[model samples]
Target: MNQAVGVVLLSHSEELASGAAELVAQIGAVNVPVAVAGGDAKGGLGTSYHRIQEALEAADRGVGLVVPPDLGSAVLMTRTVLEDHPHHDAVIVDAPFVEGAIAAAVAAAGGADLATVLASAEKARSVRKF
Candidate 1:
């Protein structure tokens, strides 16, 4: 069986991350593994390296992992976590938080591989409304 790619959503607000995950599930990616890492240990609006690390571990299920951060600091924290955990099969995508997570999750639900899922998330950058 093909392993579905996993997604990790990072945001400064726990509600934002969890809400995005829920939206992704509602959008038909319920089977895909999506982990959320948002807010600090004290439940403040900030990213936590430890929380991100835990989310990464939880999201990765033999398949590769995709990380999309909601803010610049969250992105930096995710990068730091990945740097520390060099063996993780993961990539950090530069894309909008909600759109990227939903796109990646949809691709993953279709059993797309790591690269494809990452591409899907990055592709969200070109999404425009005219």
Candidate 2:
């Protein structure tokens, strides 16, 4: 496993991604790469999809998790990205936004297996509210 796992936090809002980045930074000195795809407000999937692809490509060899603000968009993007990357080891999760991003960053930094990290994140979201 790589010593450092890159994380891409996909949010419509830069501030949300920034907040997640700040939280992840607090957890440890991990190189969690955050890319705010579309603006905070609800935008078309196309806008975020292209940016997400760009960010994912940038985080090569690193696991990725999508942290969208809303459920519909989150679900849609997760399905699209995962279906497109069926064989990828990147941890694409649809858990709560900030907490999921933080968990992913910690798991990535710890070199935790993508499956384990994703499962942990999914379970950990029990405490997260939206």
Q: Itemize residue pairs with steric clashes in candidate 2.
A: 12-39
Error of 1 at 80 (Å): 1.6
Compared with the true structure, what per-residue lDDT tens digits does model 2 show for residues 16-49?
A: 6667777888888455555555443355333365
Q: What TM-score, to 2 decimals, does candidate 1 have?
A: 0.94
- Per lDDT, the best of the predicted structures is 1
Give one digit per residue, the lDDT tens place, for model 1 in 53-92: 9999988888899989988888788888889986368888
TM-score of each: 0.94, 0.69
Off by over 4 Å in 2: 1-3, 29-35, 38-47, 62-70, 81-87, 128-130
lDDT of 2: 0.60
As a TM-score, model 2 comes out at 0.69
